[model samples]
Target: MTALVLSLAAVGVILAFLGWIFPAGSVREIVVGSVMVACLFANAILLLAGDGVVGWREAWWNVLLLVSAVLAVAGGGPLTTSVLALVDRGNTRAQSTQKAGEVLRGGALIGCLERAAIFASVVAGWPEGLAIVLAIKGLARYPELRSPDQPASVTPQAVAERFIIGTFTSVLWSVACAGLLLSR
Candidate 1:
């Protein structure tokens, strides 16, 4: 069960990466999303199958969680990529690189956000809550990441800043996870 918890998180990260890296027409979204949802749903089911969690015993909640999984896997990227993707309009390399950065940032945000959401939903026996939080973004957002000093840009660190936030977010997730585990 504990291993499932960790893998579910890994699934989330993978979805975040693919959502940002792959173009809209690509099958990455469907495949990654489906796998992520399935991993989470299975975890939820296993967590509830016995006398472990109380409200989790309900069958209807299980159905709801499964359906929610479908929805979660459907969405993509961060706020930026989504907006830009809608605006940029293609499968260009510029778009891919930009969106990749956005995905990294967004994945970091969800690292903490999804865990908090999942922890809350677990107590409520509403496993789908995690999926809802995960779907906050749709399609890739960033799509034209400039290197910050390419003849008309600024500093290299400027570009690194976007990725920096993502690293922080991942660290935060790790610390929080460690806290949860240590307390147990």
Candidate 2:
């Protein structure tokens, strides 16, 4: 399960890089959405299969993942954002075209954060990390967020920073896991 989660993350990361660098929102969203779905299934099957890993701790994280997956689909969160952005760039106004980049960049950041957080929560048994990831998704949806002075560079690294920061959530999650393991 962990391996699958890691694999999905790795693939998503690569896709995000490709998509962002090429300024191609179409390919980026497709890959990101696929990653989330794959992780959701892998996580669920891994838990349900009962390979001696299922427990109360895991149950909570699974529930969170379920909720996340549902939200992801219903709201078209990352998937729609990436696709729409790309489409807009191809056939839309200048502002909309630029906005697409913001959305994609933000979506990429959120996608990375979400996966990293979920993986961390699963391994570390910490739901806060997951919650944090949830909050980040909203911020990644815009162009000016922090101080409202962010430029419109639309570079991959600029967007990837959000993912990198999100990846740190996993480290914090590991700390939580260490604490839990020690307690046990």
Candidate 3:
């Protein structure tokens, strides 16, 4: 059991680094997806093998859950960014070019903060907080989405898609991370 715990921790560390470095793409996506799936599987295996006790002491399990939660939150933003970049890759619209850096920086920051909050909320057993966070996010970004004063570099649809896709990705990743922790 200790060996399994340590191995998962090691894998978590490596995956965290890879996520930090690559953030997105086929490689990043595959690695992140695989690690997440493994986490889920590990929890199931432990539960089944231990007859619902999970076997590990509270401290050990807590540490594992904490580390996994942090890794998932940290990786969520970059994964979202990478996926969104891929989604918009073929878009040669002026909106994709103009102020792209600014938009990306802002979006990434929001994603990081949002995912962190969502992850914490779920882990702390406050699922309702997700609604508040998402509501605030939607309200905060609504004006930009509905803005009629479009410059050549911006489009309402693009902005909306960015918000929608980014928010969904961030929230889903956080939820999956939380679910993994709860599984065992």
Best by TM-score: 3
Candidate 1 runs further than 4 Å off:
51-184
**For candidate 3, lDDT tens digit of each residue in 1-184?**
6556546655764665576676355566656755755654575475556543256678877776776677657767656766666776678675452234334347767777888888888878998999989999989877666667656676666667777777898898778666656645
Model 2 segments more than 4 A misplaced: 1-23, 27-36, 39-43, 46-91, 94-118, 131-184
The C-alpha RMSD in Å for every predicted model, in order, reads 12.0, 10.5, 3.6
- Residue 64, candidate 3: Cα error in Å is 1.4
TM-score of each: 0.32, 0.35, 0.75
In candidate 3, how many Å is residue 30 off?
A: 7.0
Residue-level lDDT of model 1, residues 6-80, one tens digit each, is: 456455555655665666434554465455445545645555553323344446444334433322322323322
Model 3 pairs whose backbones collide: none
lDDT leaderboard ranking: 3, 2, 1
The candidate with the higher lDDT, 1 or 3, is: 3
In model 3, which regions exceed 4 Å deviation?
Answer: 23-53, 95-101
Q: What TM-score, to 2 decimals, does candidate 3 have? A: 0.75
